[model samples]
Target chain A: MEQPMTPEASLRLIDEMLQQAKRSFSRMSFYFLLWGALLLVATLTEYAMNRAGLPNGWLGWPILGTLGGIISAVHGSREGRKAGASTFTDRVFMWVWMAFTFTLVIIIISCVQVGQRPGPWVSILTAMPTLISGGILRFRPLILGGVLFWVFGLLALFQWPEHGALLFALALLLGYIVPGFLLKRQEDGLRTA
Target chain B: MAFAPLDPVLHNQLRLAVISLLVAVEEGDFNFLLEKTGATRGNLSVQLTKLKEAGYIAVTKSFKDNYPNTLCRITPQGLSAFEQYVKAIKSYLDK
Candidate 1:
């Protein structure tokens, strides 16, 4: 026969287990870093090509976007399999990004049909997931990243066409790349500590 | 107020620990629960079976990379029971 736990002990155990589960989902910085770098490269390349009066500059978007999608799929599936367990937080986070991706694709296609730039729309779309993710992770930097996206998004919408790509690139740097690195550092610290 | 009785199925230490973990995550495999609880494999297996039999959790057996895998997920009934248990515990503590 096993001993029974008092209410206090049971409460403590519940708290401890919840903490452990939370830690299990900390390895999420990789996606932010990966997508940020890819988008930054594509945006800068498109901007440079547009400046140099080069043809096919817009091709960078499709090429890099496809590559990012492939990498995200492969990496996400592999990590999911390795995790052995999934949490409600994990499912919610995955759906948020998936919805973002689906809507972004539609926005881009619609913009292309109307011969309009997708920069502002992309920026606006990026903010929601980033902010929601920050709230989910309880990380301030990501939340700030989301706010930066909104600011840059509005700027890209209203500013001159020539500056749209620059603003987009800047948003990726601050909104995705910087916070991505911060999240990675935090996860590393937790692992090592 | 009268004291409500604790659910015997959840009053044991190991069983309660297992349920506590399952309640937090969508699903957890045998290894995950074992790692979190630091219990012997046999002991964890026994407790998992008990919980399953009590309708507190659903257990599924599958394979991963050709290795056997056991996954556990808490049922809605289990969640309701857990909520009741917590309320009961709080009532006792209020005394």
Candidate 2:
């Protein structure tokens, strides 16, 4: 039998284990970057098409959205297989993002039914997951990214409709792409260290 | 002032380490535990078995990528015991 440890040693052991477990949560920058870039492209394409007086300019969303979904699903499963273990933090992240996706779909469907543009609503909804994810990761960039989403979302809602897509794209760039790359760099540093 | 006795099952160094790790995560694999604890395979297996026997953790055996994989998750009972153990340890330190 192994020797019993003193209370002090036991406490230290617990702290070490907690820290190690925390480090095990793989920071997922790929999803953020991927979705961010895809949304940015889709929004820009929609804006340009509308300016060009092209019919069915809105088709950019459904098409790119489906593509994004497929890529996300594939990437998620690949990452899942590579992970040696699952932490509580990982599960929380999964559920939070899943809830966001669910809510987004509902919002889109509702907007379509009522003939309202889903742009502002989607932007507003994006803030929640981004903010919650930032809080969970304790990453300040993501927290600021979440705030940017809200600011742009409101601007898109009440400001110039013609420029709404531009504001949405700006939010995606700062809120998702920039922070995502920063997070990726941080994860890379940790991995290399 | 009386201090509560530490749970004997969790008093051992290796077992305590294993439980401490388990409490932090949803589930961990045999390799994860072995790597984290730096325990020999035989020793980790023994401690894991003991924890399973104590009903502190649920162990599942499965095959992943054509290799045997053992996953361990803390049970409600295990979490409760761990909480009590922390309280006991705190009380001892407080004294």
lDDT of 2 at A31: 85
Q: Which consecutive 10 residues in model 1 chain A have the weakest lDDT in total? A: A17-26
lDDT assessment of candidate 1: 0.88
TM-score of 1: 0.89
Instruction: Please report, as a value between 0 and 1, the fraction of native contacts recovered by candidate 1.
Output: 0.66
Chain A superposition TM-score per model: 0.91, 0.88
For model 2, the stretches where C-alpha displacement exceeds 4 angstroms are A1-4, A109-116, A185-193, B1-3, B63-67, B91-95
What ranges in model 1 sit over 4 Å off?
Answer: A1-4, A190-193, B1-4, B90-95
User: Who wins the DockQ comparison?
Assistant: 2
Candidate 2 residue pairs that clash: none
Estimate every model's Cα lDDT from 0 to 1: 0.88, 0.88
How much does each candidate deviate at the interface, measured as C-alpha RMSD after superposition?
A: 1.9, 1.7
* Clash counts for all predictions: 0, 0
Structural similarity to truth (TM-score) of each candidate: 0.89, 0.86
What tens-digit string does per-residue lDDT give for candidate 2 at B18-81?
9998998889999888888889999999999999999999999999889999999999999999
Q: Please state the CAPRI-style docking class of candidate 1.
A: medium
